[model samples]
Target: MRRPLIGIALVAVMGIVVWQWPGSDAVASAGAPRAAIASQPVANHGNWLATPTADGKLTMVAGGQLVIDAELRRLFDFLLTDSAEKPIRQIKDNARKVLAERLAPGAANVAYTLFERYIAYRDALGNVKPAADATPARLADVVGRRNALRRQFFSEEEANGLFGEEERYDRFTLDRMAIEADVSKSAADKRAALEALENALPPALRQARREPVTHLVEADKAAELRAKGASDEDLFRWRSQEFGAAAASRLGELDREQAAWEARLDRFAAERNRIQADASLSAERKQQAILALQNSQFTTQEQLRLDAALALRARQ
Candidate 1:
């Protein structure tokens, strides 16, 4: 099977992105990446969660078709996933490209070049599994053609690009993470999750590198805003409206809350002054009455306060 010459991108399906408001700096930079993490299948149906509404399965049923070992399904899935992820594929690709600047230089890392070339090949042949006859000879021939048309790892630079120590570490980490995450999953689920992960990896890492820089930029902008005496109220209000709505949209939380009661209390106290200019209320006397009422905690006293407030407000 021939691999894809180009990567898969679903962005063409999503029409006209509406930008956030003009001055709302809360928006991710136009260049900022939206990343897709590996999707976990909670599906109990043999690990298939979402079947294509039309096709009725996430991938073609690999059973009785591939004529390969159980582990071969993942190899097939790696080939099947498009250049673009379900979401973060674009950014992830960019990250890969950025990393490729280092990885592609080394011809010594056959794994990196082999993996990359096979990926293109796999993408090209999509959805169609090899007819149980993809024997060693045929597979070797396909891999050879890929090697010929692809990177020969011919130079020091190409070797460097193909294998960097740091790059190797990242690849190992991702490979282990992918394996660990989907070990319990069925073939389809594992492939789907791994594909989601592989497609997202490159750009996600790039954005990770960009994060501290973006944060620094944001901090500088904030200091400038503060110097200009910009109040946090506006920024907070805008972002609170923009971002927190998702967090706030949750319902059924009322069940978790205890009932609340609002209570008011009032009492009349007599005043007697000996040799004073007039019989008047003192702060000390008021404090004593409030303490007594609070200590009593009487509902009738609360009712009395409410009634008195209503009468007083009515007179006003």
Candidate 2:
């Protein structure tokens, strides 16, 4: 043990000394090929287990010096890097393996289902062919444009069409440079808009403009609902899809229904209020008759969601 410790100390000292030398990078490169790994992390060698399974798969945003822009990566360089045949092959093979795994232990029915769908899609395409485009790229050999290339290999597009689409490559080619150009234009526009908005804000509301308004909007709505005698529980119920959701989701149908209801309610309430104010319907009579029937119990959250949806629809 003492000898081993002494040897380790000597090795560490030598390693530091050599690493500090002028030609160390070249030496490290030369040695990289010769080094033997004593162990491998789960992420090594393109293993399926290496990739993490996120709770809900989403297109996550990545940026900075480390991240290459997706539009450029996918639509430009990656599309033309000696063709995508290898990665395509990888996707095909891996997809088949994934299907087999999913259908393991007599899961023939599911496997058949996936395969049938895949084949049917291919059949519908008629004359297109498959390429081995699914294989992942190897980077360490490449030079300065490496990171840009690296970004392409692990791009959103590749991830999107991960499962084998046998006929995809035969029909379409990715135009990465054009895509990158668009991305650059979009980013520039966004930055310009933000800057313009900030300049217009007279230095007072700049911070407020940049911050999230979802919760603030929610609070304002709840307060309004409270003013209308709506209990918190009523709001919660409406938010939890306890109201108006069971109706059909066809926007035209919903619009017509909502319009009719709103028009009827507005006219009815206005007439009722006018009658009540005329001293014809006493407060006691109004309470016992019309007012008692029109109790609107709803959550502020629900109202906020509706307002937001309506705003979006109007914008559209």
Candidate with the greatest TM-score versus the true structure? 2
Per-residue lDDT, model 1, residue 226, is: 61
* Backbone collision tally, model 2: 20
- TM for candidate 1 is 0.18
lDDT of each: 0.33, 0.32
* Model 2, C-alpha of 194: deviation from truth (Å): 13
lDDT, residue 120, model 1: 53
| Tens-digit lDDT string for candidate 1 (148-257) | 33244224343233223223323433353445455488888777766675566555343333332443454465467668886655444433353353222221122123
Candidate with best lDDT: 1
Q: Tell me the deviation in Å of residue 15 in model 1.
A: 20
What TM-score against the true fold does each predicted structure earn? 0.18, 0.19
Off by over 4 Å in 2: 1-249, 292-316
- After TM-score superposition, the amount by which residue 84's alpha carbon in candidate 1 deviates from its true location, in angstroms, is 24
